[model samples]
Target: MNKKQSGIIVTLVVLIVIAGYLATKVNGPLYVNDSDFNEKTAISLKEGKSSSTFFTEATLSRDQDNAKTLQNIKALIDDANTPKEQKATAADEYLAVATATQNESDIELALKAQGFDAALCSIVDDKVEIFVKSSKKELSKEELRGIQDVVMSKTKLEKIDVKIKE
Candidate 1:
């Protein structure tokens, strides 16, 4: 092949590789699954901790996802091409998301402080969901009530759901 044609081919190959890499990075898994939580809990227990600590692998993965989402919103808000009205809307959403993320962190800490092995909380559309990791794979009524009370007190949200996982 001619040198010019060879050069063009190389450039196209480079661009394709770059596009693929960017797509994978942006489209990566955004949330952890049940198995991830279970594996993290098992590892935590094997490490000799009586109770799992805050910020397990699953929790960290969640935090990373939240951070990326917030960052994207901020970028949209700052983009000059975005309409003023859209920017305003994005700003409001950013504030709400930031607040909810902070509340989730606080709730998780409160659950841990209350002697739970590990906990994760998420707020969506005014509803709160909590996932607590327990070695026993089950929680008593009182335990569930206590978690609900803590969540209510912390977030002041009427809709709260708690799940215990082993």
Candidate 2:
């Protein structure tokens, strides 16, 4: 790996160690809103679904999408007709998505360990999108920061957007 890649891996390892330390030292369940979510997932917010149920449903949808992508990647890899460069690109994408999936799982586990009722983390490019079920509609600055820190520690992303999963 190149210097930049090695540096990022080192930073991620340190952040993960820190996240494990921080995860044991927080409390509270709350949420905020992102305008982007309001625009995108407006339908899912209706009908007063239970927070845990909503999280389950949304996670299923996301997993389904990821599975489809993985299947396509597998097809590309298996097909002798496909170009090597295309297969290589698909393989890279597969690894990145798999890593992001693990990172999301870790972040959610950490948030729940921090006392969140339900936490859903999605990493898109360099941005992290978090959907959390809150006991209160508003989160204090400290609470918000705690959530962001957990996510940032698990992922290389610094741009985090949190939304209410009510």
Candidate 3:
């Protein structure tokens, strides 16, 4: 082999070795978008085999304070600007609207599924808002809308807004 060819071959060999070492030394894959880190890192940090662990529904009964709030909602709905005799007819719609407009369980589940720490929930002005915290991005608007739709179907309210902590 000629000297020039040997020199080029040696340079290429050195580059390959350096590249291999760098790749191996990397602690984790590069994350560019919010989701890139949220999904993958969340997956790694979670323990055990099931993703279900992260998505488990927040137990309502466990939170005595929120349970009392829910009781107050029942009373409010009873006294809402609607007739008593006609209440039965609107029962389905009432339940649907109230729950959809105020339900926070599903939202809690979604937040947990995404590996975020979510709180019980608070009902303000007939709206259900949840407080969530995490190193990752907060829950998305679309997700909250879906949960709201479920609760809205139970109430008399025409529209409801479900807010997530920022």
Among these predictions, the greatest TM-score belongs to 2
lDDT of 2 at 111: 92
User: Between candidates 1 and 2, which one is better according to TM-score?
Assistant: 2
**Highest-scoring model, lDDT:** 2
The global Cα lDDT (0 to 1) of model 2 is 0.81
**How far out, in Å, is residue 86 in model 3?**
6.5
lDDT of each: 0.79, 0.81, 0.50
Candidate 3 deviant stretches above 4 angstroms? 1-86, 89-102, 123-128, 135-166
User: Which lDDT tens digits does candidate 3 get at residues 1-166?
Assistant: 9999999999999999998778867855432234443543343323342333332333332333344444554554577686776566556545644554345555455555655555444444555545554344555677665555544543334345444332
Candidate 1 residue 115 Cα shift, in angstroms, is 0.6
Write candidate 1's Cα lDDT for 88-162 as tens digits: 999999998898898899988988888987888989888998988887767888888888888888778989888
Work out candidate 2's RMSD over C-alphas.
18.4
For each predicted model, how many residue pairs clash, with residues at least 3 apart or on different chains?
0, 0, 17
Q: List runs of model 1 lying over 4 Å from the truth.
A: 1-55
Candidate 2 is scored at a TM of 0.69
Error of 3 at 87 (Å): 3.8
Candidate order by decreasing lDDT:
2, 1, 3
lDDT of 2 by residue, 46-142 (tens): 4478888889877886776676677777878879999999989989998998898889889999999988889988888999999888978888898
- Angstrom error of the Cα, residue 82, model 1: value is 1.8
